[model samples]
Target: MSMERIATALDRVSAALRRKPQAGIHDDAAATARWDGGLRTRVLHDAGHELLTDMPAEIGGEDGAPTPGWFMRAGLASCAVTRIAMAAAAEGIRLETLEARASSRSDTRGMLLIPEADGSAVPAQPLEIALHVRIGAPGVPAERLRTLVEWTARCSPVGCTVEQPMPLALHVDVAS
Candidate 1:
């Protein structure tokens, strides 16, 4: 879809969430760790009394352009970075290219059930990831730089959560 269309759709989703009452968000501080065969997942909330997450980059994403599935992928990507960027920064790592793409594999029986995940491990959710990272500070050695990335992945709240699920939930979505 055109970027304009995506923007409009994102506007609507954002508007809807803003309209929700603050008291509606529960837990503010609680969640669970999920394991499906091999993939790991986590459901966390510092919703802090807010009903939704503060990922403005996404809620304001291309309107219905993302369809719900695409939107979820965006969130997955955003959160993946959200949970790791700090670690990279703390280590004083300089990053140039950091791209993580998520994939899904679903059975003929049912797909698209991931969004319904209520703070639980949504199998086949982000089935595979192709990560391309380039980091080289003025003085950091390549080997040491690689370790920083390893540490990031190790502490990646979302990716690390899904390392063991066999056949994990793998599916793809087509924006209609």
Candidate 2:
């Protein structure tokens, strides 16, 4: 059996006064290559379980985990930070720091790890992610950072996740 996902992001958004930005999105995933020369150690992904605990303690975290979700943990943070950096660079604003953290919960009454519909064992959906980003843009006004947030909200992967509903698309591209 095979699973297929379809995704389409608007290249242009509507604007009241001027034309909106030109941007697009594709699909991606978190995994390592199947082959390596000598080192072949497997790594666990933080996905939903360990996403919250994989951060520094000074920045709102306890920092306890067995190397969880190293791949997905920074998915949103990196993307969002990159966008902010780009915006700041474009405006000649210097940045000092950037960070992202995430937490999540499901409507399972705090019982099941993943809520199931129709008593099916399979996971019905991904839980909600409470994501936050802290960016230190020196010499940049707060209003400009707000604009950067707006732009990232429309462009970054994590930003898109926060904007609309849950995940509705998945794609695995590979050829050999």
TM-score of each: 0.40, 0.47
Q: Give the per-residue lDDT of model 2 (tens digit) for 13-39.
A: 223213523332433445443322222
lDDT leader? 2
What candidate 2 gets wrong by more than 4 Å, as runs, is 1-70, 106-124, 161-176
Q: Native-vs-model 1 lDDT?
A: 0.49
How well does candidate 2 match the true structure in TM-score terms? 0.47
lDDT (Cα, tens digit) per residue for candidate 1, span 1-176: 44345456656655777897574456534443232222223334455332222212333322312333443555456655544445455554555545556555443213334443365545543445444454446666878767766777776645554554356465677779
As for candidate 2, its clashing pairs are: 45-69, 46-69
**What's the true lDDT of residue 89 in model 1?**
56
lDDT agreement with native, every candidate: 0.49, 0.51
State residue 143's C-alpha deviation in candidate 1, in Å: 2.2
Prediction RMSDs, each to the true structure: 16.8, 12.5
Over all chains combined, what TM-score does candidate 1 have? 0.40
